[model samples]
Target: MLDDRQTRTEKLAGEIADAILEGTLEPGSRLDEHMLAGRYGTSRTPVREALRQLATTGLIELRPRRGAIVAKVTSEQLEMLFIAMGELEATCARLSAMSMTPIERRRLGAHYDQMGEMVAQDDVPAYTAANTALHAMFYAGAHNPVLSEMTAGLRRRLAPFRRAQFRAPGRLARSHAEHGAVVRAVLAGDAASAHAAMLHHVSLVEDAFEQLAGAPAGTAPEAARMKAG
Candidate 1:
């Protein structure tokens, strides 16, 4: 039932969301409709729709007269999101540990191998992509689709601030190590350890967001490092 324009608008929305997650679209940046339309090879109508979608997800804010701008991530919001993310991921780990079958754990092991390759190469883009996959797969492994959906929504909402964590010095390497620990804990079926490890992983992000607030706004915040997985 979807028309071409509607499909295009949805696709553009996804692209914009990805850009926000990757830190290419910095927070608080104004989104000019004409420019976005030109950038995406579309008309203003589609661009507007895409912006509307981002607004609904809380990634961007639409203002009267001033138009749309990337939503500013305040310190309080950052802390709240980070804290919530930790709790949610901890719950995911606990659920996955209690419910995942041996075969599911094996599949997660393979995915970890793929992640290892990305980490070894220090390929941020590949690692980021794999990070997303690992987290999604974990939710699946947990046997709770509802929790996965909720977590996914939260991730999208906090994408910009999350990406900024990767900019911190030595964060990527530390994150890689932490991810390995999380994998081991999950594979071992240690529900408590898994929960704690996941919380620790998300706490790293909290540290990054805090450091970012101490610095000037609009500055790149990627150095702090986070294990989104």
Candidate 2:
């Protein structure tokens, strides 16, 4: 069915995105559709669709004749993206604090607790999924469709870089603690506090990525340095 093919393409795109984030697929490296199709045990059609999808996320660059390559972002561009994302998310958090219903607040808290468990178990993938859900919940709680759509678009564009930060050692715990501040502020209906907390959390995420930027993706030398200390 058409839906199944779409699902498969999405799955392939996610796998390629992960590879790019982890440095297995280095930025600027050409992605051959034939090779990818062979690797994923599929035809070129799904591979092409997957590449097209990634291109929209700013993770893949499609050339007229050169095929697809991982998109390379300059440090300045990354900084701008993070700054924009932080501001947008902070606004959402503030609005959520002011607008979220009691049930929404409770559900957000429950999701935060589940993320903590994922962190404790060292389940990075699950934690990442939960983290994505938590942010979506914040957007939903804000009760602003336009703001939510804009934030979601930016988040998608920066998804790979943002996800890569979790590879830093102790990042999961730190992120959870940061989320706690946001959750507490939101639950208390302190919009200013929620805004501040969310902004701080996003800044820390940028810091985490900066710390890892120098090393090969999977190695995370900053993590090792912290552990050695």
Candidate 3:
């Protein structure tokens, strides 16, 4: 069993990761160990662990003397990750459609309903959370543990970019619709359609990334709202 300090270290890691993903910590921003320790009411140990994990995820760079700085996303890297993620997610959706059990299907349906409720309330955080859960469930339903694990790792690497992408106008609404289509295909066991829907859904994200490729990170209007959601 893990001790309290170890558990706190892991929790701090997750919190820092979320801050990175949500752009609360902007790209290239320095992560000060002392400041974070003071902010989170912990010692330097957990903050160091958190920073180390972020460094591994490419969300931060650990400089020998300067401590950690948030990683900057290049256009090429953004395009590459989105293309790969789309292919992987499409494959997962295809397999999930074929493998989904009745219980899993019902649970997936419930997730969609919950997502709809979030959208109805214009709760972007809730919608985004449900969106993540729904896709995670789809990944599990696919039954390929290896692919699921790899996809999850890639998802974490791409989170910061994704948060920026979501700030684009109409993106969230369109994401909800695309997810609905994917759920429909999965429920009907239409593997091909499910794959296509997922591909197209991720393609939307790719389009946004492409458009923003040349734009300065904080200069773009959508990028400016990275902290909004």
Candidate 4:
């Protein structure tokens, strides 16, 4: 039951995020839990959870009296978030290279290999899931609880955008290749290489999002323009 609820919440969150990013739901649009529940044929509980998920991404604001309001995530803000995410991930990768136990490294390698199979099968959802899991391993391998916590927080903030990145053409394969670089560096215990590779991979992730959104890297989204008007 718990897993089902979480699945529903994540699915609804993804759908709502799609609407927002596609300009179907412009900035300032009201997201009434009751209406959303009806619209999506779900209970208010899931609707609320979905909205809360979106709130973490800065794609919507949950206000005291206003309930939920779609918010304009400016290009500048997006860029800054990406920049921070890249740095955090890079640091984590570097630390993981230096600190991951041999057993942990073996598990990480096996996990990455499974992702390769997902890519071969063109299983976007599976690849996305595995990709997330692989990153979590890197964070855990860092052995710095504070750094790991901070990186996880930023990752949640960018979750929506990062998930959308997989929808881009050839992104799954490209992402896997990028991971290969980082994984190889980490496996070799080359901290500097791991840092550079992970940072480069994240930069490409931002690029992938821009390409899919039809927006230049770090520019205001159409929803922002709609709000401005």
Candidate 5:
């Protein structure tokens, strides 16, 4: 069925994205469709679709003659992307604090609780799915369609890196704690606090990713200071 094919394509895309984030597929490495198809035990159609989808996330580049290659994301580019994503998410959190109804807030809280359970069980994949849902709830709670769309777009672009952060030791617990801060602030209708909490949470995510990637540790402290302030 068409739905099955789509699901397979998405699964393949996520696998490829994970490989890139884990450094198994280094930046600038060529991705041969036929090779991937053989490796994944799938047809070339799904492989091609998966690569095209990855291209949309800026994780891979599909060239006319050269096929697909991993996109090189420089440190500066990563920093800028995180900054933009953080600000946008913070803004959404602030708006959500001001706008989310009681029922919506409760739903978000319930989702967070589920994420907590996932974390306690050390279920990274489940936690990641719950984390994504929690964020989607925040976006939806903002009640601003345009803002939600923009945030969703940025989130997609950062998906691989954000998912990679979970691989860091103790990151799940820390991430859950950060989410608690945001949840409490939102439930209390404290816009400023919600914004700060989200901003700090996003910054910490960037730091976790950097640590995983063996990058230099310079921006994390500043982000921590912001969280403290």
Candidate 6:
């Protein structure tokens, strides 16, 4: 029951995050728990939990006496977050290139192959979920528990922005191509190349999000509806 409740909270958090990213919930807008519970058709319990979780992500701000409001982030702040995240991810790729077991490398390869099918089908949601899995594998293959924990935490915070990039036209194929570079370098044990490729890939991700954020209001298609991290 606890696990199920946790899942519901996480799901609600993702939905609310998506609305913020898509401009449905503008920055600095109040997030009333009661209203949100009604909007998402859940009780106040999960709605409250979801708001608390999103607060950690800097997506929403919680006040003492007041309720929550969407946190207003500047472009520079967003860039800095992506910079930190990209650097950590690059380091993980570098270490994995040097240390991952042969079997682990093969598994990464197989996972990449599966993602290719997702791209071919133009299945944005599947591709995004697989993208998160691929990064998780890279983090685990690095074999540093502390690094993995920190990286994954930041990733959860960046989930809404990172996943929103795929909604851009042709971004799925481009992202796959970028991952191809990182995968090849990791499989071949090229630490330098893997690091460089992963860094470059994340930089592009930041750019994609920026472009998506600037689009006209209400132009967004229905979000693929998957959790980012």
Please report the candidate that would top TM-score against the real structure: 4
The TM-score of candidate 6 is 0.92
Write down the worst ten-residue block by lDDT for model 3. 220-229
- Per-residue lDDT of 110 in model 3: 89
Give the Cα lDDT of each candidate: 0.75, 0.86, 0.77, 0.89, 0.87, 0.87
lDDT score, candidate 6: 0.87
Model 5 C-alpha lDDT per residue in residues 102-198, reported as the tens digit of each score: 9999899888888888998999988988899899999999999999999999998888788878888999999999999999999999999999999
Tens digit per residue, CA lDDT, model 2, 1-229: 9999988987898888877765677777899988998888999999999999889778789998998988775666667788999999999999999999999999999999989899989999899889999999889999999999999989988876778788788999999999999999999999999999999999998888777665644543222223223
Worst 10 residues of 4 by lDDT: 220-229
TM-score against truth, every candidate: 0.77, 0.88, 0.78, 0.93, 0.91, 0.92
lDDT of the structure predicted as candidate 3: 0.77
Better of 1 and 2 by lDDT: 2
- Whole-model alpha-carbon lDDT for candidate 1: 0.75
In candidate 6, what are the lDDT values of residues 18-134, reduced to their tens digit? 888876887778999889999999899999999999998888899988789888766666777899999999999999999999999999999999999999999987898899999
Weakest 10 consecutive residues of candidate 2 by summed lDDT: 220-229
Ranking by TM-score: 4, 6, 5, 2, 3, 1
lDDT of 3 at 91: 91
lDDT score, candidate 6, position 50: 95
> Which stretches in model 1 have alpha-carbon errors above 4 Å?
1-30, 39-46, 63-66, 212-229
TM-score of 4: 0.93
lDDT of each residue in 1-229, candidate 1, tens digit only: 4697777876798778656655568777899989888888888988999998778767789999989987754545556777888898888988888888998899888988887777678787677667778887778877888898888888777765665566667667777777777888889988999899989988977776556534543343232222221
| CA deviation > 4 Å runs, candidate 4 | 215-229
lDDT of 4 by residue, 1-229 (tens): 9998899899999889877876767788899889888888999999999999989889999999889999988778888899999999999999999999999999999999999999999999888889889999999999999999999999988887898888788999999999999999999999999999999999999888877777542343573343333
Shift in Å, residue 146, candidate 5: 0.5
